[model samples]
Target: MTSVLALTAATAQADAFNRIASFPTHLNNAEANAESSAEIISATADGMTLVYSDSPLEVIGLIDITDPANPKAKGNIAVGGEPTAVSVIGNTAFVGVNTSESYTAPSGMIKAFDLATMTETAVCDLGGQPDSTAAAPDGSFIAVAIENERDEDLGDGRTGQLPGGFLVTVDVVDGSLDCDTVNVIDVTGIAEISPEDPEPEFVDINAAGEIVLTMQENNHMVVATKDGVINHFSAGQVDLENIDATDERGALVFTESQPNRLREPDAVQWIDDNHFAIANEGDMDGGSRGWTIFNKDGTEVYENGTGFEKAIIAAGHYPDKRSDSKGVEPEGMEFGIFNDTPMAFILAERSSIVGVYDLTDPSAPVLAQLLPSGVGPEGAVAIPGRNLFVTANEVDLIEDGGVRSHVMIYELTDAAASYPQLTSAGTDELIGWGAISGMSAGAGSTVYAVNDSFYGYQPTIFTIDTATTPATITDATVVTRGGHPAQKLDMEGVYFDGEGFWIASEGRTDRMIPHGLYHVDMDGNIDAEIPLPAELLAVERRFGFEGITRVGDTLWMAVQREWADDPENHVKLVAYNLETEQWGAVHYQKADPDTGWVGLSEIVAHGDYVYVIERDNQIGGAAVTKKIYRIAAADMVAAPLGDDLPVVSKEEVRDLIPDLTSLNGYVVDKIEGLAIMEDGTAWISTDNDGVDDSSGETYFWSPGKF
Candidate 1:
């Protein structure tokens, strides 16, 4: 029996740095603040910190963190501008101040503050402007991601070019407040990493004095010199299991043995100046556990084996638990593997568990620990000084009351030391009103969380916790999105380009019916909505879309078509052109009378190719060959829709893509959705919404001919 003394010992020690404290509170997992944007700047040993966007110059809030137990309110910084990125360097704080009432472009300001004096140090005027900023360790340089006035229109309503933004390095060598041209790294020239498109997110930089690493949201990392020179050798997709780049020359050395898919890379950290860890929120629809590890040279060091493999192994060992526990939906991750083993602190989105992995052995890592929390946990950061791992609980608020948003802190306990297990260690919930989505760390260890009301009934953007002086969460100012809910339901994923975000809303309601694609600006407003035609909208019981991908201005959606006639009818693929607003659909067809498609689950386009996940019709009472169809987009567009209506026969589709019987692995259940990784690999998900079978699982399909 577990004794009282043992239980007390298992309890986490109260550290003034790691404890959870409530300060500036608001709505959570709610619709009220739909379009609200919150981001975590940094986490410290004394207390955790954050920053949120409100409106005007009152858009900055400061919270006190002297006591981890109770985070007090320090005050507010009236920057009189809509702040975008919040970072702190020494006694000075930096914020991306926008002039527009909402988050538009015309003018912007780079406001500097003396955290000690709590006064503005300097302000620089710029256009298009800085989206995100990273301060140099010694306070020498501040690298800002800037774009030439957002130009061009991507059907979705956002105005950034194919590779819109550029990186501008500001020289802070002299304490001059005057604005002058420093250095700029033009991203417009960078080749599209993925054959499909490229959406790069500049992650963390190495603390090493010389070299800094910037990782993309889509999983590409580029090492740059302090002078803004790109180390092309160190740039590529994060595919390996483990990657460490600690050499003084800023050389990226990786594991050259085996390679794998590096899911959605949301965060990156330096292990010790060389070795680093990447947080991959594995693809849900694609059935990847998400997180993986890579060395500096772009080789995969550790991977959460394909989703199906993990499920198979888990079921083999803990069949009972496997039957109930939905596998990990990993997202933002920080390295802190339990029991002195190489581990990762994974943000499991769906299960809302902080999953710990023991990657002592890169190839086959074990599920170390899983700390439970509120719904839809996204980004996470490991603050070793505080012995606490924090996660952004970005839950979707579909119900009226709204699920509470959370900035959760979990104290790393020794319970796993004596008995290293994957379990919860209790969490301290902080202020969260709207769904807290994205998170990042800035100067001064200030943690910033983005509270995005993407799918809420109302849209607003707010900045919480302005300065690190005392570390208090202050709502900088409130920026509203015209005050109308884009009515986006089940908003699942969020990607920040510094300028704003391309948020993915997994619309799962009859109200919105099928689902739609939306764009929310940095200042909390629905810039525009790109939706499918009424035909694509899943009727009473029909097709529903879940996944989306945008390349340049081109957008692709993966929609699942339900059997409308006999429950055994095949599904169709709908492809829409963001430019001309043209729509084209391809229905599944099979030559064999018995091997017909019951449903068409997912659609993904890369280069000139397009792939679709097809659900199989019953074969001998069991699903056989749920295939992935690779068709040329041009050919798809050329396919006749028959008198302006989408209708295709099984035999016609069979003729379009030959050999349906010769695909890779097979799923015996309903294949629902699909998503493509940064590395061109495909991940598919299954739905058991109706079946009594526990066959609802995800699978990873490698890049190959089907």
Candidate 2:
């Protein structure tokens, strides 16, 4: 018994990196609805403090991570220019400040500040716009990539403009920068793509003091020492297959190919003294949609090809809107060795995920995990000594009432992975899924769910296995009409009735998506579509059926909000009889608005009650109502449509605020899915809004037996 107990305890403590906390960038600004950002990040030598560059706010922000699980905002420092990147070494912070007046007259400065006093100590004129800043492992020097980035509006955004960019190295002596020892290396006439304009994108230094850089727009890379450039080569091209190459189609079809696709690498990080990796976040021409490891002598050690993109797809993070340009857009990366395991973290900008790979074998890296990022992760830093990783998400959608820019902290601990709470990792075919709106429990551990209008062109029904950790999406079936992929559907609910599924679609008349219900067989063939009745359609104001479920011979639909004729704060729980083909509804008393309007998102029938999710549209701190309410099954009597409907009373089942905040993230707005099983266990989920102006975090968790 002792040995068995010891083994169980050992297994319970895992060796993985899990997110501990997130600090919003606007916290340091003291401004509400401020347009702030956290772009590139760095940390002090002890890893107790963090510094990030906020370009739009023109400041360098600081955070005290003395307690990694509870990061506190230290405040922001004015840099007097657009701070593009920052690197911290001991007590000094070397920041690359871009003061470029125009594309042709590009100029910037690399400034060093005392972290304690928060004052500028030394500065060096970079002679061009700087992109990435990195410090040598031994803290001997700092390297800045002088990008002098091109103006996309001018000359069709192609490179080869005048005043080519170069690399600058500043000596760091006694933990302080020495502006006099700054060495500039001319990196021109190297790459075959644009030899005249070599715009360096990212830089990294190894323990051996060798600095490596990537010229993204030029599709090139360079290796240099303090004295001069040693070797230069093309970032190279890849023939990508099985990729979704078309955008605005609202579907994930990986049948297209981009032949000889250029790998416009964006971020570079050294794995060791001999090898390094680059994130191919292409500009101008191409983005390989993955990462690559290369030897110091220009040999391709490992080419990710489409592997990383496919993994992102499996995690339900495929950004269909960016399919034509760069899918997911692998942009930032960091490498570290923790607990004898060498790992490389690659950031997917558009999908808002960090793909963690075990680089034990650089030539054959194993993708270990995909952690959810806040949104638009632009830069990252890995502190192996402290067993921590950090990401700076650059996009702040405050004006749009979206989540603010956040610097997420992940700590390597003896705890299991807590993110990606839902995935399609082991499915038969690669299934891209998101916007999980409504769900219904089936036999045993199976649950059926549907995607909303965000993927309107490809209506789909997903089968979920609740028995697995992260709740696996086992299969996906696209709803079809006459053997063609059904388009213009905003599927909000799905129900499995032993042999087939009942689907509810939430529509918008302006966008041409209809509000209706679908009877789909097991094979995804639509047997019939049930449109709203004349009276219901006349009163509809785009807030249509959000969920559907069955009881005896009746199909109950939860109208999202109050219609034109319904009383204030009362939504319709419409019912349809399969045998009688009649439409009726009962008024559901919803809560009054605290910040935004409250409405029902999902409905499920089981045992002796009918469950519904009532939530407010507000997110973060403004969110007030995100609850599960139940009404006795006997009270679900339906009155005829367009009449004075009887109101149904409800009792609160569970308060979902604590559940949504359990992940240590900002409270998401939509709580659209709820499913109760035979064992009385309940499952809840949220919609990610198709990752558009959203963090793209789909929370799927169980509230236990209800």
Per-residue lDDT tens digits for candidate 1, residues 1-706, read 1112112112132212221332222332123444332343443224445443333224455545555445554555667766656556645667777564323434567777765676887877654455556566566767665533333244343333333445556656454234575565544434333312233343345567433333343234555665664543223333333221122211112222224443444445544445556555432112234555565555656655433223222211111122112234444555653335455666555444455665666666666534544445555555565566655544433232233344445555443221111111111211112233322222242222332323144222323221221123333222234664444344433333346554444455554533666666766676876775554443424345434444444455444544343123444444556676766555545323354434444455556566655555452123555666666655554232232434343211221111211111112344433444434433232332211122111211122222
Give the candidate number with the greatest lDDT.
2
Error of 1 at 162 (Å): 4.7
Clashing pairs in 2: none
User: Candidate 1, after superposition: displacement of residue 59 in Å?
Assistant: 3.0
Report the lDDT of model 1 for residue 304. 55
lDDT of 2 by residue, 588-680 (tens): 999999776899999999888999999998887778899989999999999998778999999998888877776677788999999889899
Superposed Cα deviation of residue 454, candidate 2 (Å): 1.6
RMSD for each model, in Å, please?
Answer: 23.7, 3.2
Worst 10 residues of 1 by lDDT: 418-427
For each candidate, the alpha-carbon lDDT, in order, equals: 0.42, 0.88
**Number of backbone clashes in candidate 1:** 89
Q: Which candidate is the best by TM-score?
A: 2
